[model samples]
Structures are given as structure tokens and as C-alpha cells.
Target: MTEYSEISARLAALSDDQLTVVLQAATAGRPAFWAVRAALDEMAGVGNVTPGTDVSPATAAPGVHDQVTGGGVSGQVGAASTVPAVPVHPAGIPDAPAPGGYSSGGVPTFESVRDKVEQRFGTAQGMGELDRQTPAGRSADEQWEAREKAARERLDRIRKSMHDNDTP
Candidate 1:
């Protein structure tokens, strides 16, 4: 007999409990087998076979109907359709409007740039607040110095270990 026929004959011989276990194993490995598992679970429930051990199938995969009708996936399905668009400024232009209605030939002054940065990031108070929040108050230069010192200390420790080994 062919493989299909042999498999069918074997399946036909399995008790309802054995079939339920096989269906659970198959569905657990692959979500696509969920539908078949669900049907088997319902059948098992009605037949009162392995009633205590019955496992319900996972929810169905999201479908086109879910997307259009907004019914299937709960919170994941019903989010707002469109996000707010980002405001755009003209090319080679800053996002802020020109100060005093005066354009300085499109070249922003250092003070203007500093003012803009401070406006967005706040004054020295902001920098102080950020520094206080961080574990170390050191700036970029201080951090680099700390890293260099740590590397040198590590190298010294390794050299000491090697010298001790050689002397012994």
C-alpha cells in the first residue's frame, strides 16, 4: 500500500485520546496547524473523551477581514490608521522662523545658533540638571581621561602578573 493509505490506516486505528495528544503535539510546533487542532478539540469535548486533558487551540491568525473590519486582533488591530506628518521647512533653511523678520543672507550667526540650541535644550540650568542626573558629572574630556587611566592600570596589572610568574 502507498504511504498515504498506510498512514490513514494507522490513524484510523488510534483511540480518541491518542489522536488528541498527536494533534496537540503537531499544533504546538506549528501555528498553521491550529485550525485542525481546534476542530479536534471541539470533537474531543463533545465526545467526552480525555475531557480533563483537553487543550484549547490558540486564537486564529490575523486575516484580511480583521484589517478591514477591525475586529480580530484586539488592541493590535485597532490603532489609528495614519500618523501625524512631520512639519517640513524649505531646503537649506532652519526649522525656526528668521529673527526680527531679517534674513542674514541664509548664513546663521554663531549667537543665533547658540540661542537655538539653548532654546531647545534649555539654559545652563538644563546642563546642570542633566549632569546631576548622570552617575558621573564628568564631561566628554573627563570620561576619555578616565578610560585612558583604566587602560594603563590594566596593562600595569598584567605586566606585574607576568613578572611574578617568571620570577617564581
Candidate 2:
């Protein structure tokens, strides 16, 4: 196989246990993990408390609930059914949670981090009328910019330290 094809096949063979270790390392303090963690925290705060529902994406065991839910083997011994099962949400749990938690209505669609940052900061231009109206909003924007700059600088320093300590 060519180098790219060999790499692709190797990646395809990675088990879920192996992938979880890679994912945790990659997302340690990043925004994507932060968002997912926030969602999980919201779920916990609401005390969903179902036997299978409390499983975290990181440590969740595959097929543990399958036995109880009748996700058992079909007529063909090893073949999984081609039909996709519809997800059933429990009562009182919101279909889509907003940034912090549950909202009044409407399903929350996934937005790009850039889009969310722009929306939060009013840089998406016409998105936030109220943000453009007030002096306090302008102050908050300035504070956000300053904090973002500091975070970037901190990351730069950490990267530099890693590079400097690398073995030749």
C-alpha cells in the first residue's frame, strides 16, 4: 500500500479504547471539549440519573445497555440490522440545550466556534442589536479582546517552552 493508504487502514483499525486516549489528549483544554463538557455537566445538574444515561462519553462501555434494551443479535448471528434506530429522549429533558442549559424552545443547532465567538462578541455585524446600543456592551467587548490576547500569549509561551525542551 501507498503511505497514505497504509495510514488510513491503520487509523480504521483503532479501537474505541485507543481513540478515547487520543481524544482526551487532543482536547485537554480546547473549546470543543469545553462545549461537550458543559453539555455533560448540564445533563448531570438536571439529575437525569437513568441507569444507562449517566455514562460519560469518555468512559462509557460499548453495548452495555444493548442487552437490557433488546439490542441483541438479530436472526443473522453477527449481522447488525441495516435499519437505524430512532433515538427516544426522556420526559422533561430538553431536545437541544442552549449554551448554559435548557432554553424556552427551539432545537439548538451546532454552530462553528468562530460563528459562536462572533455572535458572543457582536462581530457578526447585524446579529446583536442590543450589543451595539450600549456603552457597557462596548466595555465588555474590550475586556473580551484583552482576555483573548492574553490567552494567545500564554499558549505561545507554552509552545515555545515545549519546542525549547525537545530532543534534537
- Name the best candidate (by lDDT): 1
User: Candidate 1 has what TM-score?
Assistant: 0.24
Local distance difference test, each candidate: 0.59, 0.55
Clashes of 2: 0
| Pairs with backbone N, CA or C atoms under 3 Å apart (clashes), candidate 1 | none
Runs of candidate 2 with Cα error greater than 4 angstroms are 1-127
Note the clash tally of each candidate. 0, 0
Minimum summed lDDT over a 10-residue window in model 2 is located at: 65-74
User: Tens digits of per-residue lDDT for model 1 on 48-167?
Assistant: 456445365675654663333322122355554222222223467654435753344576766777778878777777887888667686566588889999999999999999999998
